[model samples]
Target: MPESIGPRDEGDTEPVRLPDGNLEHLDATVRQLLDQSAEQARQLDNLASAPAGSPFAGFPPGPAMPAPAPAPRPILELEGEEFESEVDTLTDWVETFLMDTYGDEVSTAAPWCLQWQEHEDVLAWLHALWLAYHQHKEPDAGLAGMAVWHRDFLTHTMAAVRAPGGSLSACMTDPDRPAHRILPGPQRSARRTGASTPDTGEAPA
Candidate 1:
């Protein structure tokens, strides 16, 4: 670096040695800068090469969209302890909330069984209702969730489940005259013999 320093042939040609730490740090800094510049240049090139009016043009890639939620499942598919557990929770919702609010006047037309859970059909319908109620109440269900439940799940299910000949009809047509019965299921053999062509498929009936 000084004029006094001679050519390699005439004097020492070894380069000035910096401290090991300082040299390593300087090398790392230079490499990092080069790598950053290269990345910026690649991004710019991508933008320039993008096709006009392309959805990807001039825009950075965004975060991936979340996976869709799973559809609700049937309650009857559960077995053993799982079936019992779900039914317990469903029973709580029915007694504490649903009945307290919507248990209308008992009559022959709109029958409601005092022991509705004993009816297999009632269990199925109420289980479906309970599942929908929870699904719509979730944050993902949006602001109209409860209203949707009332319309799509509640209103429709209530009408069908409480019809005069609905599942509960045989149980509690009149609360004052409460009774429970599971209508006899005809023997499968008899049913098939009669309905095989008769009960099942009548002659163009």
Candidate 2:
């Protein structure tokens, strides 16, 4: 009888093992193919959603918006001669601005006053007043009052008046009038009489 090499213990049920190197290479190829498909899908999605109004509707722009121009460096130091000259020019105007705005109340007993004539350093003093003026022009009375007060009192206390916080609001409020007292306007009367308040946010040009 021929050697019984025909019959094996395990029939066709056993799984065939692949070479380790071949299996690794196959896996790598499959991953690469999957990654390529994902990338292609992203590109399709981007193309479909391109905005019609944008300049780069089809593709990304080559360059982005240019950065803002660098701020100019200040030439004059706060206490320098150049700064003094600038302050001097502004002094006359500032003093006149206050006087014209408040008239006699600026002279009399008032919470806010600008005695521009009393200061020895007219230029610096004037600059201080101007700083105060700008500060008082704010919509918020508290902020404006704060700026003016800081500019007026703090300007004297400190050697330099470089930073005056409430000056803008100070300029806005009538120096003669307290912060609570609203200026004479139709709006004020309306509010007091339980009438409708008109749009007073923007003043006529």
Candidate 3:
């Protein structure tokens, strides 16, 4: 009770005595903290000096990306004799297909018509139609393919070729004479029988 210790002031940083081992431990701890602080400062400096949009400013770079591939081309671009050969082949196949599929309907539906295989314009149109239609002619399409051929392809083609002033009509007068009328169908047969029977002639006994 002879002397009393007072509380330390806020600004007090006076050195305290310690054992030799304790002093060495304190020195090593201070050096480690200083080293950690220096490393943090170095990283901050690098970030501040880095250029705009640099991935290294905040994170490391990753792997590079690959380029895209090119698109495919179509198969209907033959030239010269090759084009003629292709058209001929396609026209033959289509004509056979139509005859085998809907010969009777075509024979009556559009009686006065061009031989589509011989007519370049008709062949071209039909060939394109066949190419487009065949793409969807898998086994699953079944009767739907034939239905579409008749309803969409055949209907449009017959109309275009048989209309009064259509491609077939134009072909009738072509200098090359590539097209001709198909006869002996139901409509023509009826007309012929009617014409042969005279109005004033008496009935046979």
Best by TM-score: 1
lDDT of 1 by residue, 1-205 (tens): 6678566775658588899999999999999999999888877887888898787865556799999996756778878998788889999999999988987888898888777877777889999999899989999999999999999999888888888877777878877898877766556664455543654556332
| Deviation in Å, model 3, residue 139 alpha carbon | 2.8
Instruction: Give the whole-model CA lDDT for all candidates, comma-separated.
Output: 0.82, 0.49, 0.60
Q: Rank candidates by lDDT, best first.
A: 1, 3, 2
Q: Which segments of model 1 are wrong by more than 4 Å? A: 1-72, 185-205
Prediction RMSDs, each to the true structure: 7.8, 18.7, 19.4
Indicate whether candidate 1 or candidate 3 has the larger TM-score: 1
- lDDT by residue (37-65, candidate 2, tens digit) is 98777766766788768655546335678
Off-target runs (Cα >4 Å) in candidate 2 are 1-11, 52-66, 71-205
Candidate 3 residues 1-205, lDDT tens each?
5776554777676577899999999999999999999888878887887798887884433578787653322324556887767766775776677546644333323333445555555666666666656654766777587677667777787566555554455334433344474333236553545544366564423
TM-score winner between candidates 1 and 2: 1
Output the worst ten-in-a-row residue range by lDDT, candidate 3.
104-113
TM-score of 1: 0.56
